[model samples]
Target: MAADCEAWLNANPVEAEDLSDSFISAEEDNGGSGGTNKNIHNEINGNWLSSSSNNLHEARLKAKAKRRLRKNSSRDSGRGDSLSDNGEVARGTPIAPTSPKSKLLDRKSRMGKGRGLPKKGGAGGKGVWGRSGEVYELVEVDKKDPNFDEDQENCVYETVVPPLDERDFEKTVTPIVQEYFEHGDTNEVAELLADLNLGPMRSEVPSLAVSLALEAKASQRELTSRLLVDLCGSVLSHSDMESSFDKLLRDLPDLVLDTPGAPQLVGQFIARAVSDQILSKSYIEGYKGKVDCEHARAALDRAAVLLKMSLGGLRIDTHWGTGGGQRPVIQLIKEMNLLLKEYILSGDGKEAERCLRDLEVPHFHHEFVYEAIVMVLESRGEKTFKMVLQLLKSLSLSSIITVDQMRRGYERVYMDIDEINIDVPLAYFILEQFVDKSFRMGIIGVKLRDQCPHRNRKRLVSEGDGGVVKFERY
Candidate 1:
């Protein structure tokens, strides 16, 4: 197009000298006539010449294209024949790709192409950014960037992709869960456990699930925690009400009571554990709840009997069953009494009285209020001999005396220290000035060596109303 425009301008030069000097100028009409005649003739001739030049240029282009195509066909035919003669392609000689896009495929497979391509910049004629491995053509962004609203030079344009959910970014989601329990997707797993249908797997669910949840919580396995909590609930539910009265003795456990639960739930759970013989033996014997009505007393006695029978199978000290385990049972009893105290405080003296009767504490020396503990080993329904004890084994004489409002109970030989509730300066005064003073005297024993024919003589002594003993001093 440029050449055609230039030719037209050169041929039409105004000055004769300029026309002669022009590269594309027409010949002058040196043999022609006047300026008017010459001007008309020149106009006619110029029009024809321009049309002729255009036609000739188009024809020349078509001929050149045909020649080049013919040469290419010849070269291809020759190469095909040579290849047909041999079994394999020549080394280092690249075979022509059958497809129009083969040129690109060949280049892509070359080693280190990625490294070299980026430096060369864009693929094809795109210039700067064309060579992205699997290239995407850049469409000019017609929208103005909102970030430009701020005049600061901090605007950064990142490659835009669709927003992704966790599934789309799992490589990243793994860590996201770990950051914190509340926010992380890891809870989804636990939630899934919560959703599990327990219809067929009810029993197994708790055992399996609780173990897993505990493990996860302990080991910090966030993914596993969901199932764990769900399982814990199931285990707790199953532990209750599955055992029977006979098995109750061995089934009760202090742990069942100690585990966190609604008060009622904990009590029920303990009852069930006891029924199943799952409680520690010592625990059964000593089991106590806040309430000590006939129901709890019966349960406690049943547990204690079973514990005694099942001692062989129990350790009750450290791991399984041992002597230390007996403490939990003691605790249960104490707890029951404490509950009774609450009843007493609440003006439910009738219930409190019932509790004292069930525990076999003297009717007046109610268990919680009375300082003495009367331990009776009854046999054959006969109340011949009695042994009195204190609830908390060791107590300072001072506190015991002040706290000993109820009269201390008595055994056949040992007076119930609880009898102090009777009167006078009370237990404190008795312990400080009377019981502790003379009670220290060792038991009286007659010398068998010189006691003619082993006759028990002069071995008897007695105490006065003040617990002071007088001896014959022989």
Candidate 2:
């Protein structure tokens, strides 16, 4: 039997204890031995039952542990599946419950915010992170690759400008000045000059303009000269341009004197301008009315002097008339002076008649000499007063300037007595002498107003403190 047991044990070596327990339990149930065997069977049966119960309890515990493991595994796998929805994961990873807990916690944390923390990504949602806690980095989309150097090899940048030459200068500056002269648009002139970088040379603009005009065609020369005159007129119209025009006009004398043949050219220029009616006597008078009198006088005087100087030495090729054989610029220069003098003695007829001999245009003699007698009365100069009286005597003898013309002339020069600048008594004396002479000459209908028209006249009688006497006509 022991040999058989040994063979059985060897046959089932791994389950030897289990087989022995079962065999012992079966033997206990049979009850085939004596009292000693029976007692042993009873104890063995009790031990077998306890061992079986313990084995069943252990099996249940193992099954319960396996179920718990499966449930937990499914829960972790579901969380891993959700995370897989977010993105794929690497293989063999024992997914932890941390995924669902972390996600739920992350959601709850986001909801509890007051002022929220700044998001992980900035503008354009760049560099965002995934739900799986993975990072997504930003990269250049439209920008050229900074790493490439192929374009740099073929490109270059130049900083230096080529120098401007004379041809280009003429091409650029000539049209600008010409347009200015034509339209008389000062702002356009300024803007064009500024574009050419010539704004800094503004003081030389007029001279440069003149040079350009001389270089222009003869057909356009008259227009250019007229433009210069208009430019001067516009410039002199403003108070700020007074000094500029003065400076320009002052510079003209030197320009004429220093340059050979310039005066003759200028003379021809003036003759053409005058004939074209570009330089009108009325326009010049209007310009003089606009500018300072001193400047106007100086400019005219300088031009006259320049012409006279030209006549002194230079023999210009140009002549004034076709067959009249007149000198070109000399007559115009004299005419300029005569016009200035006529302007100076505008209202006084007696002075106008006396100065009429100096004027070439006899048509204006009536306009100029209409107030000669009044001019003599208003004269502050003793010589001018006597000369005017002598002219009136000669006119009275010739019966040219009649008593009616004298009356009209007197009425014109007569302002208020207080406004008169000459000595009142002396003026009255001169007037009395003229009246006595008119009476002796058998001039009838000579009218005269006695006593000052404006009663605000004062006289010095005795050359003392009480000499000043105020007279009022009643």
Candidate 3:
């Protein structure tokens, strides 16, 4: 019967309409037992429908179960079973979730493996673990090592400068002092001194500077005095200054050989230094009786006289007197006039040259030139004119007055010739003669000759007389 049922199910597919028709036909054919048959047919139909639905549900459930089994198998394979201590597999062990730090370490370990780096327990790169069973310790840098200097390891070095000696100091400082004389900049001199390692020879600075001043012009002496004052207590200590002045006193005889007035100048320097506090009061007193050299004694006496003056040591500052450009313009003019007047009286070219040198106004030589030419023009006697001309010639030949200065002087006279003519009617004639003479003597250039002014001569006719008087310009 089961075979028949299976064969019937396989041959005829179940349809709702066909099933309903079969139920209705069975009900009709069994009408005498209709109620019982109808009940039975309903039961059979219900069972068949329920059985089909159940079979579909069972099939879906089986497929889901199979998927679950396959997933479990894959998951279990990926995380193989852990072994017990007895070597038996342990089932159903929970895996704890991996932390981020552990995961990163795991990834690093994998990367290290690819690079052929040893594991944590094995020795490999620097500072890594040793491969031996016993862990090897890392070697530390020993502090006692002969070449070890932690500070020096990171330090940078600079080049060391060698010290300068005495002869070298003199050679270097002489030009420096000469330059100071030219510019008279004490601060600049101080900066230059600071650069040098004067060492123990620092006391030599004042002596050398004063010595140079003694031989130099008054302007240089004044500058040197100021230099000593500025450098005192700063570059040169009080002791250095005293020793230097002592040395200068001892060397005064030698200094006087070249400069006859060295004693007086040294006296002035000593007084000035003492007044400026570069040297103490005892500096002069120390040599009062002990100074055996006549020059040194004279210097000390001069210093004593200066200190005893009403103005006290203050007078020493002006001891050298202001010469060069330091003097007032009017004072300079007066001095120059005095110099010219003295030259006129004495008629000594050497004395005139000496006075000009004492003036120390090389830059103002043009003024001297102008004064000389004007003096010649104002003078009446030929001898005076010749004397002035001779002086100009001497100055020109000696280069005491440059050609540029001579030309400028002549040009100045020409510019003011008309005014000069108002004062002295014969001024034009005298200037013409002077220019011609100077040009002939090669004291001035030809440019001045061409520039010489010519006076205009006019002809006058007497009224009603018809007589012509020719007015001639000298």
How should the candidates be ordered by TM-score, best one leading?
Answer: 3, 2, 1
Question: Rank by lDDT, descending?
Answer: 3, 2, 1
lDDT of 3 by residue, 67-141 (tens): 655654554454457443355664654232235365456534322235554555466668755666875568876
lDDT of 1 by residue, 1-474 (tens): 646654654664333432232223223444443343433322433563455554444344444544654654554553443331234453323233346464455544233225555344556564454556765768754447764444454478866544434344333333333443334343454454344333333333322222222222322332233323333443324332222222322322432343322222223333334434444334544445633444444445544544454466652222211111223546535755575436423645445444443442223333333322222211111121111212222122323322233322222113333343244223322233222222232111123112211122342334444554221121
Best by TM-score: 3
**What are the clashing pairs of model 2?**
349-371, 349-372, 350-371, 350-372
Off by over 4 Å in 1: 1-71, 74-78, 81-279, 288-290, 308-474
Instruction: Give candidates' CA RMSD values in order.
Output: 29.4, 26.3, 21.4
Candidate 2: misplaced stretches above 4 Å? Answer: 1-384, 399-404, 415-418, 421-444, 448-459, 463-474
> What are the lDDT scores of the predictions, listed in order?
0.35, 0.46, 0.76
Least well predicted 10-residue stretch by lDDT in candidate 1: 378-387
| TM-scores of the models, in the order given | 0.17, 0.22, 0.62
- Better by lDDT, candidate 3 or 2: 3
Model 3 segments more than 4 A misplaced: 1-148, 151-160, 310-314, 457-474
Candidate 2: tens digits of C-alpha lDDT, residues 175-229: 7887764565666665555455433333344445655554444434444555544
